[model samples]
Target: MTNFFDQFMSPTYLGVPLMALALTLPWVLYPTPSSRWLNNRLLTLQAWFINRFTQQLLLPLNTGGHKWAVMFTSLMLFLLTINLMGLLPYTFTPTTQLSLNMGLAVPLWLATVIIGMRNQPTIALGHLLPEGTPPLLVPILIIIETISLFIRPLALGVRLTANLTAGHLLIQLIATAVFVLMSTMPTVAIITATVLFLLTLLEVAVAMIQAYVFVLLLSLYLQENV
Candidate 1:
């Protein structure tokens, strides 16, 4: 297990799963659906829809089809992959690393803010200021808003990092205890092992749930701000 940890922690390989996950999840969830019309005419319905409504006719891709579904599922799948990857014996959970979690959270936060500002330029700053702010309070309000804007990404990063770090450490400690106890007596060891097994299962579920929750929050932020 120690050897396994060393191998898993190797820098060259540590990020491969994250990269593969980013690409593979998007592909798997948004795989191209087959159609006779597309094969015969070389014009996929999806492509045609985009060409007609989005580019030519000036419309948004809000038909609530593969585009939206794929966006959501992709986020969830990537997070889940990262979360579960940690559960594999000896693997260092990427989410437990603040830098990795920050990498994800920062981009999402920026995207939400940038998209909102771009789409609603006039209202974006005002949204932060609120209507009741007094004339003298405008400068203070601006400072507060700026801080809040920055805090969003920081908060997201810390939240995931804290959760993963604490959970992984707890599991490791429990497993260690069970192993030592098992050496002392077979019967007690068996019971301890059973508890460890249950904790492992619970840990897996928590990891997945945390990933889902992270993505869900990002989606909500996008929906609200964008």
Candidate 2:
């Protein structure tokens, strides 16, 4: 009961709700309906440069849809903020949980499926099992395709959750080590502190990298299926 109550009311639970609010607040404050600058030239040029950079850095993740590309970039930004928040001494990283990552990943996979179906309803399922497949292999191919479809979101969730959890656990272990060393050797503690700080910087990089990886994979899946 204690564990259940704590899980329900913990900062980890609240943080995700707050993050969703944060994501939507900007739209509310700037209200696109009243905006005169939705397609400003400067913004377009900026997006162009950013897209070009992402194309080079995330070669495999790139899909041809401009709208999907923009959304993918935004998702990366949001995930990066949430992941890096854990490094702030007192904050929690919600993405470290498989459930939270699943929340993001499942929607992405669903969107790909729904949109792909709508865009090409007559052949969406057919695309998965491909034509010219052996008559005897049709049933096998269908099952394989179904499993592959399910694995898309599963892989996405596992990758993000594992990376974020490992990074946070590593930071915690290093901090514990530093504290232990401080008791027996002052110089060792100082060295450990420096190393820990360096690792914290690396964690920030990992946060950004993982976010990119998630978004990139999402885009790739959408492109292939849609």
Candidate 3:
């Protein structure tokens, strides 16, 4: 029903317009930097994760690109938190909105392209055409490559929006089926509920993976530019 899709819509709270609280909640929840020889398990675990992720993400990039390490890592954390939080009852996922996703994608994608053009114009332009191309196909290839280059941010935005929207719809449908069948077919309802539980677990994994992928692709873009 239309009501199922309505859950994804943004809701206003009181008189103030609020987007996903999950966007800011993670930062508030994070512990402040402390000065000590030893730290708690949670802080240690968080540190290990950030350090490991940063190392792997930056490994392929030149030293020039390392400057963005903090920004990208923060983006990854913000996305991961927003996505995971959306799985909770009564929460909205901002990433499910194409506009929000595009807003994130376009600026960052454009920045990379700009950097490439500014710092290495020849290399950036070189990406448009292959080393050896037939004269007859030159215009066609250039047009194709240009279109593809422009589509990167669009692809990024749509990919995130589609995946999250699909997963949420599936979860809602399954949950509704379980609820509707509970009295008529108890056993079937139980099975459906079990499947819903499993799907929730899968959705959790998808949330994390998608967030990682989003950031990973951005890093690759940066790698090309820097």
What TM-score goes with each of the models?
Answer: 0.67, 0.70, 0.96
Q: Which candidate number maximizes lDDT?
A: 3
lDDT string for model 3 (53-129, tens) is: 99999999999899999989999998898889899997889899999999999999999999999999999998899
Per-residue error (Å), model 3, residue 70: 0.5
Q: Please report, in order, the local distance difference test score of every candidate based on alpha carbons.
A: 0.66, 0.72, 0.91
- Which is the leading candidate under TM-score? 3
In order of listing, the candidates' clash counts read 0, 0, 0
Stretches off by above 4 angstroms in model 3 are: none
Query: lDDT by residue for model 2 over 1-226, one digit each (tens)?
Result: 2332232223535445554543444344321322455666765665665677557544654243445765676676567667766567655566777887899899878988887788777767876688799999999989999898889899999998888777777777778789899989989899999988998889899998888788877777777654
Q: After best superposition, candidate 1 residue 47: deviation in angstroms?
A: 20
Model 3 RMSD, rounded to 1 decimal: 1.3
Better of 2 and 3 by TM-score: 3
**Model 2 per-residue lDDT at 121:** 74
Question: What is the per-residue lDDT of model 1 for residues 111-143, given as tens digits with 9 covering 90 to 100?
Answer: 777877887777677766879889999998899
Worst 10 residues of 3 by lDDT: 15-24
Predicted structure 3: clash tally: 0
